[model samples]
Target: MHELIVIEHEAEAGLGFFAGWLEGAGVRCEVVRPYKGEPVPERAGDGLLVLGGAASAWDDEGYGWLPATRALMARSVESGVPTLGICLGAQLMTIACGGTVERGTAGLEIGAGAIEPLPEAADDPLFSALPAGPWRAVQYHYDAMTALPAGAVRLATGSQYPNQAYRLGERAWAVQFHPEASAGIFASWTGTSDMDPLRVADLDARVREAEPELEATWRPFAEAFAAQVAME
Candidate 1:
């Protein structure tokens, strides 16, 4: 069995930078996607990660097998394995852990933006190493977790979003943004056609705008996340 169990949803969406980091770190990784009729991971998985998708956490139980999927996540958490959730993955985390996830006050968050670290992040093990102030990351989501689930510690917030990130107990984390996104992935998400812009029209503009800056920011988050997995 691989040391990590990564749950992937959506057709094109796979493990992002996190997966790359794990592979680079020499950690064996396996992907499970219910959309492809993959099985829900059991306790055998050492660490768990849920990737983002277009689906909502509650839209259709069968489309993504969210109920059982969430149960699998809960089992992983209860078993004390480290787990991470992104976007839809984050919503899944909230629902699995007895927290409520609803539409955010901010309509939609698309493309590169900033998520400020919580005051307490300076002392957090998983987040302490992150850059002190604002950090930019790729984001693409309409639904976000407003209220944290029970047993969760709210670690970070942003100007537009209140519940940007949180930790379940000590080992699990959920973030509304994409720490795993890369230029290729972003381009895949936001087509070159104006019909589907990244955040706004001619959004391909970001490719020229923040490529260097975003890559610079993505490294620390990736490294910090990798460090947490190593801790586990």
Candidate 2:
């Protein structure tokens, strides 16, 4: 079976629903928890999956394992390993490949938000499956990729963040939103955040209502990624 080397940076943000989606599509995942002292591997397996986290991608000093994680992501992209980076992982990939990431002046973009696929994504291997119109996905981030790598193809955009998703080289992709996140996971995030209790409840309720749509949209997306890993 095809296996993806998953770099999970935090406990709350494990693979969540994505693990089951990938496994159901016949791809296995071996997760490496850097927060738990598991070293990020120098190389990847059939594919690489770098999940989101609370720490900023550039906080190597504070996170300690960030430098190695960035190095691994760089190597994965350079070596043509099929890779998918989400949120913080996307920021890491951006910085690792000479792109820019900074705290969004627009503030935090939490809860379910609309993501519109760019014309460039029409032919993309992973994003081509998305609808032409705007679609909703879970989001929880303060930083944004303000600029893309030199050769990266912009795939998706949003009202708040234009660089929502992009493709680097032939095998790697990055997304600012959390496609792997479930409503329950989102509630966990809101629970720990400093947001008002009423706001948190509203956000949680929104995600719960959007759960079916999230599954319908991202399940095929995960399977598409697994298909790419299978071809490797």
Candidate 3:
């Protein structure tokens, strides 16, 4: 069994079903809440996961722990570790791997949305088993990663967001949406500061409407991550 390192950025953005998925696969997880200034472990296992955050990846000074976090993710990439990042975590991974993260024009997608498979995704090992066409994924990010790093494969995209998912090197991957989110987890995200009251309510309804499909997609995504961990 592989030991997974999960970085929690906010009180709301915890691991959700990710921890359960890993445990189900007989993997151990050690999560660190860096926003609370928690102590950073000197070493993270080869399998690493970085969750979302309210803070931007550019604001390393505001969140002083960013440099350290980036260092950890960078090490994971360079060491051939299987690293996965979600939302802001994805942006962090992009920045760590010499990519650009900037404000997106989509204005923060709050509810369930679609991600289409890229032409390059056909050869991807991780995404090969996943469904193509419009698949539902939960998102709540204002900023996005623009260009991908070298050797990164563009796996998925949507109408509004161009780069929904990408894979770095062979083992490192990052997605702009949250595959770890469950129904309860999406409910907890119902009233975040970034979303207005009316928009939040509408988004929650969309989440409920799309719950089944979202869960379906998330199941394989979670399984893919688990499989990557198992490989390490």
Candidate 4:
């Protein structure tokens, strides 16, 4: 069976729905908890799934394992390993490549919002199934990928962040939003973050209502990644 190396940055940002999705697809996941002092491997497994975190990508001093994690991601992308980077993971990939990441000028995008598929995504293996209209997804990042890596294909764009999703080379993909987050996981983030109470409540309600749709849309995307790994 194929294995996907899942990197967990923190305890709060666990795999959520993605765990079941990968298991159902027959992809075994070996999760590395760097926050717990587990060392990140020099090489990736058959595939890689880099989860989100609260720490910035450039905060190497605070998170000592970040440098190794970034190196592994860079190597995976360059070697054509099936790699998926989420939120902070996406920002890390951006910096690993020739791109840039910084505090978002548009402010923190921390709720359920719509991401429209770009024309380039029409033939993308993971994004082609998405509708042309704005597709609802959960967002919780304060930093954003200001620029894409050289030769990267932009997949989706949102109102707050233009670089919502992109594909690096033929195998690596990065998403600024949290497709793996369940309603409960999102709610946990909302409660811990310093945000307006009313806005938090509203977002919690909206995301809870959109749970089914989120599963329906992202499950297939996860499955597609698994299938690619299985084939390889």
TM-score, each model?
Answer: 0.88, 0.98, 0.93, 0.97
Q: lDDT of each prediction vs. the true structure?
A: 0.75, 0.92, 0.82, 0.91
The C-alpha RMSD of each candidate to the native structure, in angstroms, is 2.5, 0.8, 1.7, 1.0
Give residue 59's lDDT in candidate 4 (0 to 100).
99
User: How many clashes does the backbone of model 2 have?
Assistant: 0
Q: Model 1, range 1-232, lDDT digits (tens) per residue? A: 2377778887567776666666776556778767777877555366788888878888765464787778878887787777888888899989888888777667777767778888767777667766666877777788878778887888888777788888887778888888787767777876632454334545546644766776666666655655656666
List model 3 lDDT by residue over 1-232, tens digit each: 6789988988788888777877887778888887777966655785888999788988987888888888888898898888888998899989988999988866777668888888877777667767765688888778988888877888898888899999888888889998888767887877646557887788788887888887666777777777888887
Off by over 4 Å in 4: none
Measured with C-alpha atoms, the lDDT of residue 61 in candidate 2 is 84
Q: List the residue pairs that clash in candidate 2.
A: none
Global fold similarity of model 2 (TM-score): 0.98
lDDT of 4 by residue, 146-196 (tens): 989999999999988899999999989999999999999999999997788
Candidate 3 accuracy as lDDT: 0.82
Q: Which candidate is the best by TM-score?
A: 2
Winning candidate number (lDDT): 2
